[model samples]
Target: MKHIKRFIALFFIAAVLSGCKEDMVTVSYPEYTKAFRNPMKGFREYFGPGEDKIRAEYPYPYGSMTKEYMQWNMIEDDSSDGIDKIIAYSNHRWKGVEDINMKVILRVLLVWVEPWHGGKAKDPNNPDDLNGWHWPKGISPQVSPYKQIPGSVGAYVDPKDKTTPIIGGYFDPAFPERVAKLVEKIGQAWDNDPRVAYVEMGIIGEWGEHHDPDLSTYWPPHDEPEHVANRTWVPGMEKVLGDAFTKAFKNKKVMVRYAYEFKDYEFGIYWDSWSQPQEQVRGYEEMKKLGDRWKTQPIGGEITWNWGDLAKFKSFEQVVADKHTREYTIEQIRNLHCNHLGGITWANFNDPEFRKNAEILQKAMGYRFILSDFTYPSEIKNEKPLNISFKVVNTGSSPFYYNWPVEVSLLDAKTHQKVWSKTLDNVNISDWMPGDDWTIEKEAYQKPAPINEIKSSISIDKSLPDGEYIIALSVLDPAGMLPSLRFANENYFEGGYHPMGYIGVNKKPGKAMIDKSLFYDIQSDKTLRYNLNNN
Candidate 1:
């Protein structure tokens, strides 16, 4: 009797997973292989249309763009020959843009300006139009005319022809080693160039966004003392431009348009006045003393009333047209921890309700992981070892600064290919920030301690191969480890490779086929509904 029908199907799955560990939910699900959207995360394009048409018009999974490239005559001519044509036009505008894996967000403007509220330093009927550089008029490194250079131009000492008090152009005195050798040739040509995601630490002033390009000639200037010079918001030059963009981006992400005075260096705060609800809570109290430097830096910004009112917004006719102006722009993108914004040069994509109020705040921006519960062991033995348990939660707001590599693979089930892989390497996910004990807000909250109980035990790279395979999970992006992240879950498959069930490779091929699809039965353990913006 075939071993009593295999002990009645292993005692009917250990009595349906220990029958009701107090109502243990289990509603038949075992079938998957489709749910993918990983690229990088929302709204970032100022010069759009390509990157798969802005990820098919915003599926928000990577595809950013930026390019300032004036680098002050290639940083006063130490010229790394325009840093290899700006990394060969950023690797030829993302050569074959890997199905939306493009990246870029580079911003190298070593000072800029044109009619900067004050102009005519030249170009009067083309007095060789700026090709005859004469920067001394209203200094602020706000001089450009395409990095002037005729006669190797230089003749503008007029601070009223100083008897000894010159303070002009790029504030001479070896301008911080010419902006630290252009931040060491931009970390020797785009650090970790997996096309790079964020960079904007552009050597000061205009469009770089970090204040003081003579901040409108010192307006309310009496907080007095920014390393004295009667303050132009320059105290310790934000640790010399946050230690030169934390030593030239150790793997992308630098930001810095604001957060007023680089809150003591863990940089990653930007906000070009997008819906100023109290300057977005004073930019979250300017990083309330840095506690959670938005976990590994990256807040993102741009949108001071443009992008056509965020793509002609509607959120159900602004909940009767005026709901506190879309709840003060969704509480500044859910409490100012935005992860990329300013899509296609300020929203309003020919208005279609800007992707429906950007899917109601891109489902709360920044992190969004879900994968409620997962357990493995459907039969494996091709040089194997597999023990998994996942319950991930961080529903998004911030957290995911790097520690990016969390694999698991096995494909072939009908030629999907892959087969076996690993890489959990003690997963940390940058302490998985965000929280969800639930709270529309009323302070003194403390419930956010539970939901994140991720446990793992993966390994399966053994030599022999035998049969069925289709299990997936990936998080990689350590500058192109591939599997780009985007797991709010639906059992992803395509590029992000998520699948999550079906295995029977070399041995233990008897039982086990558990996979709670939309999490069935519903007994107790559930809380991983990662919102889902446009599914």
Candidate 2:
């Protein structure tokens, strides 16, 4: 009888332990099927002052911003004008951009060269034939002294007309000071603006690319002793502009044309000739030397198909269609950890094969966060600390670059409406890093992305009611506390939140109430929406 009693007691203890184990649940979510557009990453479109709408034949399926080249002359034509005019001009340029749910990557350029207007006529002698070199009212070649080249000749003389001189302000002593003032004024207007995504530290060279007069082969080579000096970047110019931009814009990320420049500053790189075969020296190799800089600063640029070796591919479609080139391009993007790209803005995505390939490329460019696992207790007592944990993985080439807030909420089981929500203070989404060191042979990152495990204990709201609720998670953009980033998970709800499992508040946990069928139905109207004044 004593042995029987001991056996029964041991059995009861074992059963209790089993019951306790069942109270905690660990759920694993599958990755989503398709790639979708997110803010501040992926391909970008071209935008200008009058162009308010995207004009692609088949609009990009995965982009969120427009790259606008803001001519310096357009913003501040006269040095005597007050800063108000510059502010007003910028505000007007982005007036309708927010309505389309897009941001602007602004580049304030001093020159634009031929084909695109901002300058004097190609035939400088003929005022009737206008071109794209836009020198401001007080800073024209006619007024400023050109000392970079000998004999008082301009640094960039017209190829067609040797007599006509196209001056770059880099050699002028007054140019840097004027640019500093302009940058300061721009910062005051755009640093806090929500519409602006990133600012290219432009103000030198043509198209703000930082290569002209000095490094340009655009005109016939002038090998004369005086012109030889012109084939180099202006001394101390990088530091001057780098310091100005760093001091001026505290909130926004700034990018320069090359990674080799601005070594002292923590500026990003915008490689104008991304993926070009011939750019191995100064472009591709230079960016590769930056090492892990892309982890913090954005690495973006246009894959030019109109010029260089890229033009040999004929069209953007062919560039990605050929297996060798396509693989090489993807390898470069992953290796460099590119955040955004252009050149595909004008690509015709009407072709099914091209569209499919483009989708793969889009997913490879920016941060694609995946919530692989979520664990929580079945029951939570009101006013008690509720401990929950989750694991995230970024499979894309680059990080999100911003430390946005992650929100946890309890939704009404019946209506799928949020009953209670709290933004998790512990999770820094930007630190959820992607993989690195891509290898073409393996077609994968040498170091696979690690699972970012986030464990947090949150306070449960004290309420009188006791009922079942569906637990959910979301990432807010902070612009309006709206859910803007969607996780690449199969458990995603239509309203930008991912529904985990069911839980009970101040009661015994009920059966799992998360109906996968209702996932498609809009649960809330307060979805991911963007507006200029949201900041």
The lDDT values for all models are 0.52, 0.74
On residues 1-535, what C-alpha lDDT tens digit does candidate 2 reach at each position?
9999999999999999886553667787668767676778888777434433456432356777778777777677777767687778767666666554567898887666532122434455532122356667766452322234444323443354333333445655577788788888888878887778899887676677876544332223322324334233455677778888999989888998877767778888888787788787878888888888988889898888776777788788888887877787888889989999887766776789988888878889888889866888888878887788999999999998778899999988778878888999988988988999888878888899989999989998757378888889998777667677777777877667899989887666656546566665321222356655565
> TM-score of predicted model 1?
0.32
Per-candidate clashes, comma-separated: 9, 8
Candidate 1, residue 438: CA error in Å?
11
Each candidate structure's TM-score, on Cα atoms with residue i matched to residue i, is: 0.32, 0.84
Residue 111, model 2: lDDT of 62
Best by TM-score: 2
- Residue 33 error, candidate 1, Å: 26
Clash pairs, candidate 1, are 20-24, 35-492, 39-61, 40-61, 40-62, 307-346, 307-348, 311-348, 411-419
